[model samples]
Target chain A: MDFNFTPEEEAFRDEVRAFLDENLPENGTRDMEAVAEFQRRIREKRWVGFSWPKEIGGGGGSIMEQVILKEEMARRKAPALGACFMGLAWVAPALIEYGTEEQKQRFIPDILDGKYQWCTGYSEPGSGSDLASLQCRAVREGDEYIVNGQKIWTSIAMWSKWMILLVRTQTDVEAKHDGISCLLVEMESPGLTVRPIKNMAGGDMFAEVFFDDVRVPVENRLGEENQGWKVTVSALAHERSSISEVYGLTRSLERIKVLAKSCHRNGRPASEDPGFRSRFARADARIEAMRLNGMRFLTKQLRGEPLGSETSINKLHRAQLEIELGELALEIEGGLGVLVQGDSAVPDDGLWQRHALSWPEVVIGGGTPNIQKNIIAERVLGLPKD
Target chain B: MNFGFTEEQELLRAEVRKFLDQNCPLEEVRKLCETPEGFSRSLWERMAELGWVGLTISEEGGGVGLGWVDLVVVLEEVGRSLFPSPLLSTVLAAKAVDLNGTEAQKSRWLPGLADGSRIGAVAITGDEGRLDAAGIALEGRPDGDDFTLDGEKLLVMDAQNADILVVAFRTGSGEEDLSLAVVERSAKGLNIEPHRTMDLTRRMGRLHFDGVRVSADALLGSAGSAWAAIEHLQDCAAAAVCAEMVGAAEGALKLTTDFANQRVQFGQLIGRFQGVKHPLAEMFIDIESFKSLCYYAAWLLDECSPEAPLAVSRAKAYASESFARIGVDSVQLHGAVGYTWEYDIQLYLKRAKWARPAFGDAEHHYQRVAKLRGF
Candidate 1:
């Protein structure tokens, strides 16, 4: 197999490198204006949605080109291509796939321009991994739907101007997955309330959004009235590059390596300690494995094959890798690992501790390891259902 | 960049898989357990006829000019069958010779090896079988144009069946002052002693030498300067070992999965239990990771990338351990029958466990990686 990029691809990579060299924020810090400028320039270059169709204001790049763009951007530690994270990753893609012509004209451009933040309303306190069991209700009214629901773990709800919501429109369907529908609701609509919730790392990045008779026009529904599951399914398919996550892991591992160099055990650099070395090397190897697997996943997608349950393999690997890398950081820190951010003399301002406490986002929020394992076994390995 | 197999490489893989399916079935592996030589000579020749014996031998040397990536493709299938043979030794040793052998030396050895007329074994470790500087046990003393080699090489793979032994010996006390020599097994002062290893499909032996005199022509590369080449050869071997493991673990996991699907328990399939199925799922995950890592390492080696050394260690360190984990889980998932002698699962387990410390296990590679990444 050839690992070398074709000359044209390499030249495109060079062009991306040149752009990044000029535009990437110094040391990964981008002020508000700089972020806006970064977004504007990438939009001009059509690099924001490099693989999306040009008709949708995207770059219309090939799959490998997209991989190249991401690999380079991640290697340089550049800011994300757009300011609206969920919007770019899922909301826009979902809208493009299922939106009406008017809806596309109204929403896609704003999302591409990063006009405002977007939040998701899916899981309630009682619904998590079994998200289709959500109890949120959206009753049909003339020209509009009256929504009433409580969505816990609704990330960015407090700041987001809109929410892509999943609500139960027909509760009597034979299957749990059949009755749900997706809705786009303006956050400013009356009867909506958001109470911020602090995560274990003490960050108020998400909230509990309460919907009390918030009316959304019938036209705002995504896909068919009882087929929101398909929208959600298709939207969820737009994945963040796990290879980029591998790069992030590589950076974190490098930090731990540096920490180990300075931290000493038994009068030797912790890097020289057999235990520390073994664990660190294992982290390195696991990341490499994940990187290679990411490439395989990319290959499958490029070949027009559905990813199916294989993505769970890397998801599970990431969960364990995240936990291991976080623990390794703290292990290298020794007693100082106990200190939280802002503490005087805390290592990297307690970044490792914060990461260690924030495993829920990487592990539990999307799909717990148990859930991923079940999917892999039943779907991928063709094992009997558990 | 495309990180995938070419059409040719993919076809080679399918061919190897089909060949192993026909020539080296589980029953064949079990039958060879009783064979004194461990591997069938006819089977080796048949494989040679397929050009896999010379799979990676240089085209300039009258063999296929494929790189380590192609060799890895064949090695993975070899691992899947648990086929008893000296392909690994011959491939690895032939590579060392190709890398360092003179024109005349290549002429003398490469043709015979490529045509399956000769077999080769490489001995790089001492009795400890630890693949590191501390484990270099054989000492070389100069006798004019010849060197008298003394000291035993331990865990020499298929040494008893080899026609030539390419040995690593210390020419001086310094770790870097080591040399490699290709010696005929018929040398008067040399002996091969077989060992009953845990993995019956693959035999192990120890090479004994008492002032075994070898002419200057037998020495590979410059005298006392082959240490770097040896390390490079080890890295290549490390990559091969990882590839082999990817096959072995994948095979073992498949067997256990099939068993889990059919084996009834408490009036239900055992696989319905999360205890049985989840571990198997986890095993699948581990196997895929090993496969990916091994393939990438092979790619790096084939490309001659500067990252080859680190990638090789990473693959070896992870694949070896992951294979063992799958082996244990396979047996545990299979229950009592898995532990029986009549069962074939133990062979995979033995090879998996044996592979861990065979080529600088996880711990050794960790040190290598730490050093490479700048300890």
Candidate 2:
């Protein structure tokens, strides 16, 4: 297989590099005004959602070009393409795929413009890995759905202007995946309440959202009633670019390597310690494996093949690597590892300490390692289901 | 940037797989392993006719000029069948000659190797078993038009049958002074003793060189400058072994998966138990990941990328460990039958354990990676 980019692709990569060279702020420090200006410029260039369709104000770039754009941005350590995380990642894609014409016009532009954030409402207190068994209830009336349920682990719910809520519109179904429905509800709805939950790392990036008779207009329902599971599944499967995740881990590992050189163990730099060196090198090799695996996945997508359980492999690697690297960084720090952000003696403001404690977000959030293994077994390997 | 084989390469893979399935089935492998021949001459000749032995050699060298990526496909298939042959050792020797041999040397050796009229073996490690400068205790003392060679080399694969031995020896005191010399198996003062290795699919030999005089013309590259070529050869060998391990691991996983699907336990198929199924799943993941690494390493070497060395080391290190792990788990999932000599799974287990430290073990490659990463 050819690993070299085509000349045209190379030119596109050069163009991305040129754009970043001219516009990316020195040191990659972005204040509010600079961040706004940067987003505006990328949005103007249609690089923000570069893979989305041109008919929808996107760059309409090829998948390869999108990868180049992302690689260049990650190399320069530039700010994320848009301020909206879940919105840009999944919400807009779902909307474009299944939303009504009016709904797309209403939400797509704001989401692209980074005007506000959007959070998902898939995981309930009782329904996690078994997400299809969600019990959030929404009964439809004349032109509204009376939503009433609680959604735990609603990431960014406290700050998002809207929530892509998954509700149970019907219960009497043969399959658990059938009765679930997707609804777009405004955070400002009268009966909706968001109680922020502090994570183990002492951050409130997510919340437990309570829906008490929240009146969402029937028009806000995504796709057909009782067909929202299809909408959500298809949306999540929109474009599998877990390859982009590799750049982040690569950068993180680089930082840890630098720390290894500076941090001391047994009166010598930790990087010189045989044990630490082996760990660092092993982590490095594993990350490279993930990157190559991502390329394999990208190749499948490029060949017009729909990605399935293969993505879970990298998810598993990412989970394990994130935890391993975080712990290794703290171990390099020794006693100083226990210090937090505000502690005076903390190294790098105790970034490693928080990282060590914050692994559940990556390891346990999307799907646990066990779930990923099950998917690989039953789907990829064609083994009998347990 | 596609991480896949071309259509022609895929065809080559399918053809090799079919050939092995028909000609080198498990029974044949078992039979050959039992015989002193260790491998079938007819199968070797047929594979040579298929142009596999000299796959990466240039057309001028009397073989099809293909890249490492193409060779990787055939090697993977060979690995899948557990084909008892000297293809790997022969290819590695051919690679060394192709990389450094002069026109005269190429004309003298490559054609025989390319046509499979002659077998080749690479004697890298000595008694210490380290694949490095320290491993080559053999010393080749220059005397006029010849170099007198004297040392012992151990664990030389297919050495008993190899017509040509590519021997690494110390030409000077410095580590970088290590050189490689091509010596004939019929050399006057050389002895080749075959060892009954635990892995019967391939045979190992110990070579004793007692003042064996080799013409200076047989030096593959410049004297005292063979370390670089030797390292490159090691990388090539490691990557090739990784490809083989990937194939073997895939084979083991397939057998285990089928067994789990059919075998009944406690009134249910063993595959229905998460306890039995999850390990198989884990094996699948490891194989897939290792396969990706193998393909990437093969591509990097074919492209001659500067990162090829590190990539090869990564693939080798991972495969060396993961293949062994998959082998153990596959046998475990198969229960008692997997442990029997009559069963095929034990063969894979032995191959995995044998290959764990063949070119370089996991720890050695990890150390190499750490060095390459500037740690």
Candidate 3:
């Protein structure tokens, strides 16, 4: 019923604002040294792994506080807390949940310190939403497991120093999920190769990574020998938190407002156009709805309630919203929308074009809208499974 | 930072819902919708007896003195049952009095309106339904110590049953041009032509105010000030309407899902099909989103937050479209029989249609949001 943050939370918000005033990047730009320094400051503030357990080099922040930190950071458009997007977002949490003490000690600090990057290897050419049915083979030989697999859509594979990979160690189990195993593999391993794949945005942010009989030590095996499915499920859920999307959408909305004020059509600002304002307003409302829904989930999490399948609601919304925002931005640009970056006449330097093309990362990547819908339908609503 | 109903509010919701189930069920609603009057006097009196009419006004003003958020809980239940009454109009009119009426004016009208002894309605907008200050087209000319109103108020809800009409009209060529006047329904020059609409459960009428004259004391607040009252009522009403629409959407989805669970097609339950379930699932998402937006908007208004207007517009716009989609899909998912007159799906669909544009349609609110964002 109460929407006001507690005075302490308000004070914490003030603290975050002050920190941002001093340290947030100018125009959200980041250099290597700036990135390292930013990561160091946040890690010292214990915001890098804010919601993870303190025993594993985390801040062990209360869920609500973590939400506040995230909201404020996103509002300021601050760079991500650590350099390892996948590792800090999913891998570290997975390791804390399933990895041995040795694994935690060996990996948690570097991940939090921005010392190296980590990529994911769950989706194969044939494995996406049905990731548990992966056919990437890993045969146990003495103290090492010989792996052979090709993982596609592995974003950052070319730049990552390590990977949290999923493989089939025993294909004879009764269920597909039971036969899979998780492994921590080094990218510089003798038999591994990365071939960067240029996306529609004409960027090599994602790649096709091939593992040719790579030897991963037995100690690198995460969780049980054949229980990688559980780890992957948990990690993916973490990946779909929706908190980040709320912040991201808020920033996008602000940009859209600014563009509406500046962009002109028919000898007046597009913001003055009823049609243009209506679209931007609709987007604003949807984003606000998504943001409030995110807050509801945060409230639930604060109460120690497990956020079961409801997070899918935000994921589904985020999918549509990202596409809508990109289209709206381009629409605001009128004829210049078709022009790409480096074009003299283009607006926002083709940011909207790249954004429109980047829907795959959001809409189709973590779980397609269909997959999220199915989850909401069957799990959240308790309807008959389709 | 919690954005949910309190424990007492939860109990109040259950109680209201149970009362609606007993007194305002679908069968009763259907019976009323088919009738010319479109509402049962007995049920309306019973609701009033339950103090539902005074749920939001202050104690001295003969209300429960709760805020808009609490009122949303009641509205949602009313929407779920498709309750046939003049409750929303009465409540809004009563709120207008509380916000803009002088003390003497309040004392004269507040008790009657809150206790439901006398019903009230507000004609805030005229033709085209643009809900801003400039939309007040019911012209009022200064006549000595009185004002003579001329023109009609379109789509005035429950005008036939209303005992009082709080009319928003433009008075003269001055900064203080817009004003509100409280006129009795039995006034000599006023005419109420009962009308029909897509939503049969709710009565509508055109208020033809030909030379409707009232003393200057009839005016609520200062001259040229009804705009603030109009905006306040719009914000609160929009949030409540969202709640109502979300509830109706939830109800329709339930009807659709129940039918899907039993109805077999192609040798399988229709619920087993992705076609049937996916849209129902999407409706669920929209409903949840609408619920959040409604609550947030209500919260902002209750707190008198500066962002209240934008939040309310956002809720109204999203709820309008979401409820419409849910209403249409609810019928479509039910197959051939759902479109028939005997089926209840159209009840929700019709209400969705009317409620969407009542305060402001999706496009209207979107335009409002644009303006509010300083676009």
Residue B288 C-alpha lDDT in model 1: 86
lDDT of 2 by residue, B1-375 (tens): 888888999999999999999998999899998888789999899989988888888899998989888988998999989998989998888888999899999899999999999999998665656877766778888898678998788899899999999988987777787888899988999999998788899899999889999887899988888888888888898899898998998999889889988999899988888888788877877788878888888888988899999999889888988899988888888888988988899889998988899889888888888889887
For each candidate, give its TM-score against the true structure.
Answer: 0.96, 0.97, 0.95
Candidate 1: regions farther than 4 A off = A28-30, A235-241, A303-306
User: How high is the CA lDDT of each candidate model?
Assistant: 0.85, 0.87, 0.84
- Top DockQ prediction, candidate number: 2
Candidate 2: where is the Cα deviation over 4 Å?
Answer: A27-30, A235-239
Candidate 2 backbone collisions, by pair: none
Candidate 1 lDDT, A336-366, residue by residue in tens = 8888888997988788998999988888867
Worst 10 residues of 3 chain B by lDDT: B171-180
Tell me chain A's TM-score in each of the predictions.
Answer: 0.96, 0.96, 0.94
- Residue pairs with backbone overlap in model 1: none
Rank list by DockQ: 2, 3, 1
Candidate 3 lDDT, tens digit per residue, A220-288? 999999878888655322322466667778778888888877788898988788888888888787788
Better of 1 and 2 by DockQ: 2
Please give the TM-score for the first chain of candidate 3: 0.94
Return the lDDT, model 2, position B86: 89
For each of the candidates, the C-alpha root-mean-square deviation to the true structure, in angstroms, is 1.9, 1.7, 2.3
